[model samples]
Target: MKRAFIPPADSLIAFECAARHLSFTRAAEELHLTQGAVSKQVRQLEDRLGVELFRRVRQRIVLTDAGRLYLHDIRGALENMTAATRQVMSYAGSADVLNLAVLPTFGTRWLAPRLAGFQKRFPDAGLNLSVRLQPFDFDEEPFDGAIHHGDPVWAGAIAERLFDEEVIPVASRAFRDRHDIRDPADLVRVPRLQLATRPLAWRQWFEHVGVETDAAFQGARFEQFVMISEAAIHNMGAALIPRFFVEAELASGRLVQLFDISLDQNTAYYFVYPEGRTMRPVVKTFRQWLMEEARTARTNREAMLPR
Candidate 1:
């Protein structure tokens, strides 16, 4: 049997710190160890690997070619180890903890309000929510599952479709009154608020509504939908936002739909997790509850819609 190669933890930590700072003294200060102690640890690591990891240049030090490569791999490994340790410890202390990642605006505007029902259903389960704007490797991130947007293209994961997104252009009632946006063509003349994730959103909306304009691509871009929505509400510009995200604002008449047109998004929101993995009891419970809640929400919305 081939023996596993496990480098000394202390030596690896010292080397990582020293490599990051590029100075033994700074690494020592940060690690609360003497400079000599840190240097000795690095030296021990180099001897074990039979490689000189650093090049001394007078008063300073820098990583050698080999050191740079080693640092890249070691840093990832260490981060994974730290995350694993935290995960294990959290599970030990609270077995019901469910680590979930979600988009910022979706979490705040939609999911958060409905989470109380989830809590009520699964009172014993502990839920942790963190913001993740884009897709990521499930192995690298500490999340057990994520609320994902876009295509179900996440490799090695099971993506359960939650709901499709219908987006529409909205502006503050004051802005609408000011611009007199009676026709979709009038929207073309106004400043548009863009979300960074959907750069071509306005163009798509315009095309769907059969309005061709150069202004489709012209707009102030924002990273989050919330920012764009705020800009619209404050009369900065008309924003294309998911209908569900701005339900409250629309209901309160803070913003008005520029047109009755709704564009069906190519991508949708999903509840995703690593494939072929045994789900924790808490996760299973949450998954079932979330699906039921989504169905209930869709039913309620359908009933309220003009039939």
Candidate 2:
């Protein structure tokens, strides 16, 4: 079906590149074309759309409100198209391709290592993983499923629990020694690292241990657990991190667990897929394998805990 409202693909490419750099010359250099050619393509695209995308100011260029909105939607379309092309180009004899979106740190640490087992179990199946920090619309994205870290809530999706999140306070041995921290209350005066995504992490951890402090809200914030782990390793501050993530550091003596107390988050990690898609052979097999892995991991964790 031909859509007259949609501008030419090459023109969209020109517009995207020029809008990104705000300079036709830069866009031309990247696209391996002359500046005039890029400008002509963008002008044609604007004419077709009947809207001014870019506005000039003192020889520089900036996107108009329409340009910004178009860029926001088009960028994702381009990336998804690129991903689809790559998936097709890289295809082998695999029967089913599983496209998954996962949390970055969790994907790197947990699922990645266990992937060998899945590959061996289903040698005929292919798996692709992409990093996604939060929930997204499944319809708009080219994903078969996603590993979500929060609540069991996704529209038109089936949520299966992967594991519970339990976070504990940890710090470098040197930091602990320098601060003379012995009890949960002692942490209030020292540098505390905060997770930017969950600002209430420290407050909740403190409350779990029955420690009161107004300073829980004050600290250097890091966006991800990996960053917080690195900062804490350098003695930047004490950080509250998921226990599973810091096991290696704790064993290596790089980071020390502060107290036995931990905060059990109300939220848990979940493997979610569109409800109707569960009937697919690939999705069903993966769900079974994931639940098994989750059970094994949970068992091991519980076994190590003091009885």
Candidate 3:
């Protein structure tokens, strides 16, 4: 690699730290160097870049227009480098380190509990997890694979079906009793809780249960299922929630299922990785384990639901 365009590492580090603190003295204190040393480093960086990164006005340092733009980009680059280093540090000797992204709620509620088994099966494998709510490009991110929830369409990645959801309408016991929700159609009469991401969720649920009403779209919208579940528990309204997510609530009697019929989110959960990544040992091992776990989960779910 050509080194001509690259600024000195010490210069970049010093400049970035000084830019953040806006004080050479403070930056020096943080770096455990003298203020003069920090100032000299910044001067050398400015000379190399051929642009004034900091300006002194009223005896205080501030960023120039070019400085502000460069700082923004450099911060991102530094953060990415730090993240890459951390991911590398996760690896040991010949142990495989698999970095996987997953939906926040699903990772916590569904996948977390079952992860112990994966560790047991693959003692030499390392797993690093990050939360992702939507589809992402594997090339742009450092993730080896991701657990996605949507249609099996991820541009350059191949998606392996994980499991679909079984959504049930639920509400606090008090709310259900007060409203006397006897059937699936009774949900339309009450204030229905909705998800901001899944705006048409209620309408789809109604369509699944063969119930038609104008009130389907009207409700208090929430950003996440946890919030919606809490709203339902507080007697806010009936919420259509995935059964697995509310198992504790249902079991504890905090919420009750109003109907036996479940809405299948046709867009199932999937384990996706970039093309050609299946050749990697870590990716392949985790994928097989996850697929088997998902199959077992699906089978158990199917057996329990009212037939």
**Candidate achieving the largest TM-score:** 3
Stretches off by above 4 angstroms in model 3 are 177-180, 183-186
Of candidate 1, the 10-residue stretch with the lowest lDDT total is 86-95
* Shift in Å, residue 138, candidate 2: 2.9
Q: Which lDDT tens digits does candidate 3 get at residues 2-84?
A: 78988887888888899999999899999999999999998998998999999988867999999989889888888888888
Give the per-residue lDDT digits (tens) of candidate 2, residues 1-307: 4686777889989988999899999999999999999999999988888899999898889999999999999888888888778988655777988889999888877888888888887777888889988788888887889999888999988889989988999999999999999989999999999888999988888888888888898999888898999999999999999988877899999999998888899999999998765456776788789999999989988897898
Which ranges in model 1 have alpha carbons more than 4 Å from their true place? 1-5, 101-104, 128-161, 173-180, 196-200, 233-235, 251-254, 272-280
The TM-score of predicted model 2 comes to 0.81
User: Per the 3 Å backbone cut-off, how many clashing residue pairs does candidate 1 have?
Assistant: 0
Question: In model 3, what are the clashing residue pairs, if there are any?
Answer: none
On a 0 to 100 scale, what is the lDDT of residue 79 in model 2? Answer: 87
Model 1, residue 158: C-alpha shift (Å): 5.8
Error of 2 at 216 (Å): 2.0
lDDT, residue 286, candidate 2: 82
Considering TM-score, which of the candidate structures 1 and 2 is the better prediction for this target? 2
